[model samples]
Target: MTSFAELVRYLAERFLQAGIESAALDARLLAAYAAGFSPEETVTKRDAALPPEVLDRAVEAARRRFAGEPVSRIVGAREFWGMPFGLSADTLDPRPDTEVLVEATLAWCRKHDLAGAPLRILDLGTGTGCILAGLLSELPNASGVGVDRSEGALRTARQNFARIGLDSRAFFLCGDWGDALADATFDIITCNPPYIETGDIAGLCPEVRDFDPLLALDGGKDGLKAYRDIVPQASRLLRVSGLLIFETGHRQARLVRDMLTELDAGFQTEIFPDLAGIERAVAGVRQSGGDGGRGKKKVGNPIGSG
Candidate 1:
């Protein structure tokens, strides 16, 4: 009979041999899930005998992991900003690096003395609603709208907001960029758009390329399509002095900044780095006089198009 400790070790070895990084951690996590225990609880129970059903479940999960499914995908949820968010085929798994955008937004809020203000936020490409939910959690009085093109993704985001007790303060919409949103309505806008170059997506690990929805991965041909579309709308959506923060691919921060600059929309831009010090987010403040001739710009499908 295999003990819990032995099964974990066996799984770890198999995972490592399969070229899976975080082999040990993944093994422990999958094993713990099979036993209906938290990963931390497994340490004390490691030496105990594994029930046949639990062992079988663990092995099956391990097979999925081996096939390149992410642990979060197998588990159907992921933690972002310390909150658990559910996932669906239409949504992108919320990742750790995305927290940089949250951090950047919060840092700016605090610096501007708006942390406690009743601010309005607009989250473009709100897959899973992680970014908007994270910000709303921190800003008690703030409310926000999450926009996504896929109805399925919006459904998952809505669930995520409800799960974290944030539904009352959040709304979800199906749309492209800001579209027909009222002008200067948001005090902050955050986006983590699909910026991966179409050609480079094939080079990403199986966990990403295979599992993450292509709608949330393909950024058109150049990888900056979403940014180009979103930045202009963000300038129109944000109020004077409002901030726009976006998560960018590695080395793409400079290019995004240049876009904000060329908008000539009275933006004051800055770049923020992730924990790895890669320029991961670009922030721009829509200064006074930055409405970018809002009155003359064309509108798209209405906000309730869904």
Candidate 2:
């Protein structure tokens, strides 16, 4: 029988040889998952013997990791906005960069005195329902609708909302953009749509290129298709003074802002930076009925060129 330590060492070496960036961590995670123990517990109990079935499962998981599957997908979950969310091939994995959109939205809500109200929110392309779930958790009085084009992705979002105990406060719908909510309007709208140019998908890392849904990555020829669709619809879906926020590729910030301007001449727009100091989020607010000058001047870029 292969010992627990021996299996871990073997898998770690294999993952390293396969060019996995975090080989040892992947091996440890697989081992801990198979053994039904936390990662720290696995390390503390490294001398423990492994059951044959457990070892087999660990080995198989390690092989999948070595084959370039994301560790989040391998583990079937990921952390976003300080919460755990389930994952599926049906949706794009929630990324840390998307937290920028949440942060900007939250700041806007606070500034507008809407943070504690029973605000209505709409999340487009709500993969894994991370943004909606996190927002609902933070703003107890807020309720949201999460929309995705894929039925499978909506199913996963529904399951995740239930898992996170937010089902009662949130609704999941299957439709493109805001179509499912034809007669509804919201105080806030958020999205992290596909922002990669079609041609660039081939150049992404294997974990993304091979495993992630293409529908979640390709953003048309210049990586702005979703922005074009989202901006115009947001104009119709938002109430007066409603806020629309979304994540975008770092290089596409200027173009996205321009698209929003052309979509709605009255939108007041700004950009927010990610942790890496790159401009990664674009936000716009509907102007109140008046001679609406653009609400705010462009702030200095917050995200670094990462």
RMSD of each: 6.5, 3.3
Report the lDDT tens digits of candidate 1 across residue range 1-306. 888889889999999999787999899888888888776668787788877999889989998998889999988889999998999999999889899888878888877778899999999999999999989999999999998999999999988888889999988889887885765479989999999999999999888999999999999788999998887676568787788889999778999988876674756677777889899988887766545434333322111112
Residue 5 C-alpha lDDT in model 2 = 74
CA deviation > 4 Å runs, candidate 1:
290-306
Q: What do the candidate models score in CA lDDT, each in turn? A: 0.85, 0.82
- The TM-score measured for candidate 1 stands at 0.91
- In model 1, which residue pairs have backbone atoms overlapping below 3 Å? none
Residue 45, candidate 2: how far off, in angstroms?
3.7
- Model 2 residue runs over 4 Å out of place are 1-7, 289-306
Best by TM-score: 1
- Per-residue CA lDDT of candidate 2, range 141-254, in tens? 999999999888988899998988899998888888987777899989999999999999999998899989999999999899998888878767999878888888959887
Residue 277 displacement (Å), model 2: 2.0
For all candidates, what are the clash counts?
0, 4
